[model samples]
Target chain A: MTILATEALTKRYPRVTALDQLTVSVGAGVTGLVGANGAGKSTLIKILLGLVPASEGSARVLGLDPATQGQEIRRSVGYMPEHDCLPPDQSATEFVVHMARMSGLPRTTARERAADTLRHVGLQEERYRPIGGYSTGMKQRVKLAQALVHDPKVIFLDEPTNGLDPQGRDEMLRLVHRIGTEFGISVLVCSHLLGELERVCDHVIVIEGGRLLRSSAIGELTQASQVITVEVEEGLEKLAARLTETGETVAVEGRTLALQVRADETYDLLRDAVVDLDLNLVRLEQRHARIEDVFR
Target chain B: MSQPTGVIHDIGYRHYDGPRLGRGAGAVALWVYSLRGTFGLGRTFKSKIMPFLLFGAMMLPTVVSIAIMALLKQEPMSYTDYAVFMQPIIAIFLAAQSPVLVAPDLRHKVIPLYLSRPVTIVDYIGAKLAAMIAALLILLVVPLTVQFVGEMLIDLPMPLHTHEYLAALGGSVLNAVLLASIGLALASFTPRRGLGVASVIAFYMFTLAASAVLTGVLESEGHRDAASWSILLNPFFLVNAVQANLFGTQPTEGLPFPSGAGPALILLAVVALALTGLYARYRKALAA
Candidate 1:
């Protein structure tokens, strides 16, 4: 079922149109909003949250109109903004509890949920310390904790792994995945990175230049493509030239070669070329289409 | 770094089935949060230092007045006069603490987190204004109550003390309204806490300096009525004028705008203007 949807929605500023007649719908499970900077991703979230009024069209969040019923919509949905929004002087538990209260939770319930949510986000004894001294990953956890403290029906996480290292990113992705699957909360996680979302999201919505580019389930978009990813120990350029000489579609990206498969013979042609050139082959496998391919 | 940290340990995610209150509760929560922050409650030790010191300083003179009244067995100062005389301390409190409600949110860009909740822009503003007003009322009422109790015990003038105490309390409310609205309005303009502090103090100082200079010049020029009106330039005097007129007490500044209820209406207008300024500022801030 559709949890959040915007139809022909437009937001015009004096200098530029932030969202130009954009239309998109997101169902349950983890959905990713992929876009470059200035691609109107943040603007769309603001419109859905009723932070700004749209110039035209209509939208619904959790089946309530954001334009007229923002307060009600916000009560059911949580937003983890991209910017730094944590107060330095406050501890994680204190800030999260206060945010729970802001969502209209009673004091005891707020405190209870804050503790549970902070622990759920992987913050342990450090929850008692001031957030000013927390690392970026920990701060991101606090941001996530606050978003989940009131048990929002749907959570909008903007760049949940924006500042994390590879290891941190993996951990955060796991957390996002659990929130979607284990907790039964619909998730809309926004990020510029495609590969990260490929791991956590069940559906991906690609946007560009304030318009919808594509919206599809992850399995449909990331299926094995007609192109085969060819990685070699050496002779990458020689292999590309040889594949081209054999009348096979081939493209080289850095050390990796992308050879298109026209028929079953495409794989046989690549294997024979590597053996004939006396080059060590590292990998020759069917390529899964990347979410980044949407931009192309 | 604190321990062997990265542990993927999660119990289960429990769904909240408890009662979620409406907008009124959300707004009250914000008010309570802001009010506690005003006096540095639930904050760091360094943050608590200034507010507590100011609270004690505000109460010092009232303590002294009570001591003198107990021993002398005479009227040292009337209850209303304590509020009028303690204007500078209250001004200091307003100037120093108003930014505590707004500055951090602006500087840290946390307003979105707040707006993303059930609270509206007007609810946020109203809660904050209510919080600051409550803090000021506490600062005034505590000392005033102490003096009222001490005087009653020493003199045994129950009816007179109760009447004057209630009058002083009414004046205290006026003082809180005028100071908090104006102070918060000034603080909301600047995002930097230091700058917020400076603007609030500078506004009070400029009005006071202007009022003091004009009052002196007008009195010397024999424009006595103009001198009385000049005191209204400062908001503290504006509240004083209204309070004096309402309770039939003489304004220490000059005549209490002998032209009935006009000063009270004008003071109300200033409060209205300050509130309008705050609303406009936050609306613009939220838009950005």
Candidate 2:
């Protein structure tokens, strides 16, 4: 069963259309909600989380209607919001433990769970210190910890990689990936940058103007256009001429020649083309389309 | 709905990100987080120094009152009269302070955490109001009790007997609760904290000044009793109307200050309506 489904889900603000008839179905595992800023990514996440009511259509999370069943959905779903929300006075231990207790754990159990969760987020030594005293990286970890402390069914992470340094972004992406594949939890992670989602998501849902531009498995998105790129040292003209003579459609794009190939014949054609041309095949790989390519 | 794709492994405390428990448990989790918000303690860290600062500001007058008491000998000021003078001033200060407690959450966008939870908007407003009033009670009402007790210890005539004291406590609590509610309502109207504060003060100014002007004009025109209803239009006047009844003060300018208990009660109802209207507006803005 689809963990989430939306049918023509639309949300309209006074001045902007946040989501415009967006329809998508998400299965288990990490699904990346990919779009640019103002591409309705946050709006979709809000609707899915039942925070913002949709102006049109419908949506469901785990078969519960997000519109009517917001509270029920939120009860089972964890959300790590994009903005910073840590209380300055309380220690991470106190805050997360309080959250754990609010999630219905007993006093002792909540404390244990908070400690365990904070430690799990790599905030062991500093967990007792007030969150205001922590660094941004540490603060981000606390945000992640509170979302996980309750052990929710699925988590909606809106721009988890936002405002992080390169290393922090890498760590956060790895954590997001682990949340799905390693921990076996379903994740709906949103990002405006396409490449980032490509790395961590099993399924990619691209949205524009609050509407679904495309929704497919990550592999499928990269596979639909079978264009193989090849680079050779010198003899590049000969390689293109030889490949053209052999009835392969070839075009010089930058320093490399991009060849349209049938999925099944791509390997055999490349092998014969390389041998026939006496060219040094410095590199050969399939040309993957980027999110930018879709716009172009 | 995905058929529980993986096992619910009990890793005790590993950094895995799966749903740990059930939805019923998640609701409970949000409730606890809501409490943190009520206390002005959240992941954004607004609670620590802010609440204490607010408390200190609200109770500054009490500190001044204590200092004044120490300088005087043999109870020069009647405790009842002095407390009456201080309570309204405290209420005004408390009213001004109430919106500050709520403004940060809206301005900071910290409300998303609560909105994302299984909590409804009503619960959110209720919790905020309760937290603000509770903090005000501690800051404003508690000190009044302490002062009353000190007056008794100083062997001065207790203020208005036990009943009077209870009535005073009740009046203060009502004032705080009503003022805080009004503050929250006003705060909800704007995202700018300054605007919220200014609007609340403006509300107090317009009501009091208008009532005072009308009453002054009425007395000058020899229609003393006609302006009694104007007292119902101002919260301060309405409160004073009740105070006049309780303390048996002489009619100001040959006219009953309270008019009748009926107008004051009616004014309270009107204030309630205005507050409700403000809350509705705020909720709409939040929805937007």
Candidate 3:
């Protein structure tokens, strides 16, 4: 079921329009909002959260109109901002408990929920330490815990893995997956990276320049990434010779090679091909589905 | 190697199915949290220093005055005079603590988190305003209450002292509103606590110094009317003028307050403007 939707949503600043006639519907599962920075991802989140008024459009969260029933909309929806929003002085537990109270939980329940949510987010006794001493990953955990402390129905996480290293990003994505699956809470996670979301998101909406580029199921997006593209600084001919010798069709375009995955072994063969040829690999990405691929 | 058959128990991730309190509870929670922050309660030991130091300084004069009065069997300082004389300490308290109440949220970009919840702009600002005004009221009223109790213990005339104490309390309310609004308005503009602190203190000191010099010069030049008008420049004197006119207490400026509700109305207007400024500030922050 659709938990939130925006129709013809547009937000304009004095100098530029942040969101422009963007219409999208999100259901009760993990939905990825994939867009680059300055591509109206934050603006759309704020609009859905009812923090800012859209210039010309209608929006709803949890079936409540954001313009009129903004309070009711926010009551069920949580938001974790992309930026560094945590205060340095308070401990994570204290901050999350305070946030729980802000969400209208009774004091005792707030405390109880704060402890549970912290543990759920993999925080331990370090939650009692001041947030100023926290690593980036710990701070992100605190942000997530606060959002989940009151048990919101849907949580909007803006770039939840913004500063996380690769392993941490994987863990965060797994947590997001569990939130939508195991915990049965809906999630709309925003990120600029396309590859990291394919594994966790059930649905994906791609936006660019404040406009919807594509909205599709995870299967469709992943299907489009089956064709791997690789770019190398030199020795492209030698690499292509090695790949073609391995019985895979290689298309050449300006020193970059595009190959379709005939089997799961194709990726290993491709990596070996480059290493065997001693090619200076400038780029090696399987998920580099271009804008043309998206439109297609 | 044989796989060990270890079963893992369920750890967590329970749904919160309890009753959620409504807006009133949320507002009260925010207000109390903010009030605690004003005095650095539940915060770092370093954060506690300025507020407590100022509070201790605020109480020192009243304690010494009460001790001396009790022994001498005479009145030491009037409640209104105590408020007027401790204006610097009160100003410092506002300068130091008002930023503690509001600026950190801005600097840390915490406004979005609050607005993203059920808390509206009005609810958030109202809580903050109430918390700060309450803190200011407490700072001004506690000394008045302490001295009032002290005077009663010394066997001062019950009727006269009670009446005077009530008037001071009334004046203290006005001062709290005026000072809190101005201080919070200044604090809300920039997230830089240093700037908020400096600007608030500078604003108070400059106005006090300027008012004193201008009034002194005007009175020396025999411009009694101009001198009386200049008293409104300093917020403490503005409230004192209102108190003098309303309660007929001794004017702290040592000048006859121009009669009527003019001073009171002007004080009210300044308060309204500052509050409006603070509201506008948070509205912008929320939108951002």
Best by lDDT: 1
Model 3, B1-288: lDDT tens digits are 988799646675788788988778898999999999999899888988988888888888889879887777667577887678999999999999888888889999988888887877788888988888898888889988998888877865434477778889999998988998999999888899999999899999999999889989999999999888897899988998899889988887476777799899999899999989998887777756
Relative to the unseen true structure, what is the C-alpha lDDT of residue A270 in candidate 3, on a scale of 0 to 100?
86
Q: Candidate 1: DockQ?
A: 0.85
**What ranges in model 2 sit over 4 Å off?**
A8-22, A83-115, A123-139, A223-226, A262-278, A286-296, B1-84, B87-96, B143-160, B189-214, B226-234, B243-255
Q: Quantify all predictions' global Cα lDDT against the true fold.
A: 0.88, 0.69, 0.87
Worst 10 residues of 3 chain A by lDDT: A287-296
Report the number of the highest-TM-score candidate. 1
Q: Point to the candidate with the largest DockQ.
A: 1
| DockQ for the candidates, in order | 0.85, 0.26, 0.70
* Winner on TM-score (1 vs 2): 1
Off by over 4 Å in 3: A224-292, B1-10, B157-160
Candidate 3 per-residue C-alpha lDDT over A1-296 given as tens digits, one digit per residue, 9 for 90 to 100: 98888899999999989888999999988999988789999989887877778899898888888878888778787889899999998899999999999998999999999989998898988999989999999999999998899999999999999999998998899999999999999999998887777878999999989999889888766565667778998888888888898899888877788888899899899888878788788887675453335645
Native-referenced DockQ of model 2: 0.26
lDDT of 1 by residue, A1-296 (tens): 99999999988999998888888999999999999888898999898998899999899999999999998989988999888999898899999999999999999999999999998999989999989999999999999998999999999999999889988999999999999999999999999999999999999998888888889999999998898888999889888899999999898988899888999898788889989999998887788888877777
**Best-to-worst TM-score order:** 1, 3, 2
> Mind sharing the TM-score for model 1?
0.94
Q: CA lDDT of A208 in candidate 1?
A: 82
